[model samples]
Target: MPKPIEEIQKEVVEEFSDLTDWEEKFQYLIELGEALPSYPEDKKVEEYLVPGCQSRVWLYPKEDSGNLQFLADSDTALTKGLIAILIRVFSDHKPQEIAEASLSFIDEIGLSKFLSISRRNGLNSMVNLLKNYAKNPNV
Candidate 1:
């Protein structure tokens, strides 16, 4: 079996814990965003677009055997980084795990504290959409 969701989330928290300041964390986030796999231009259409974000975010999931592998990208660097973290947490897991996993890691990493209200809303939208994709694989 793949690593447990809690382990994946905890690892993310540990990674964030090593950054002493928000500036460092932000830079780290940008690096994570930059590391995301390239998204196909054709996949950038509305069907894959993540709504309610400060920038455009596109998400697509490919199922291999039983695991859900995600493909995502964002128009803004920060949002891209944010999705990278979410992808790291949720990707390559069963649909039920993706839908049910507690996302307390967001707060644990103090990410919410730095987001603007609109950005927070956007993040929530992203989370909901991710779960929806998991639950409705046909999406």
Candidate 2:
């Protein structure tokens, strides 16, 4: 079995702790975003686009064995990195696991401070969208 979500979150936090400055953190985040799996061109549609983001972000969630698998992308590089962390924390986890989990890593890593007000709103939108997908009964 895969490591528990908490373990994954802890690892992420530890990884971020190594980067002492926000500039290095930002660069690290971009690298993380680059590591994300490719988003399908066909699935990039209006319905999947996350609302309230300054940049265009598309998120697709599929249920597999009661866990949510996500495919996400953004028009902006920084947003891409932000969403990648969200996906890393949420993906391959059960709906209950995702919905109930706390995303304190955002604060722990000082990610929120790095974001502009609009970007933070967009991050919330992305998170809400993911939670909404988890709450779907039909998935």
Error of 2 at 45 (Å): 0.6
Collision pairs in model 2: none
Candidate 2 — which residues are off by over 4 angstroms?
none
RMSD in angstroms, all models?
0.9, 1.1
Q: After superposition, how far is residue 31 of candidate 2 from its true place, in Å?
A: 0.8
Give lDDT tens digits, candidate 1, residues 44-74.
9999899888789999888988889899999
> Evaluated with TM-score, which candidate comes out highest?
1
How accurate locally, in lDDT, is each candidate? Answer: 0.91, 0.88
The top-ranked prediction according to lDDT is: 1
The residue-by-residue lDDT of candidate 2 on 1-139, one tens digit each, is 5567788889999999998898998898888889899999998999899999999999988878777899999988889999999898889988888888888888888868878899899999998988888888255
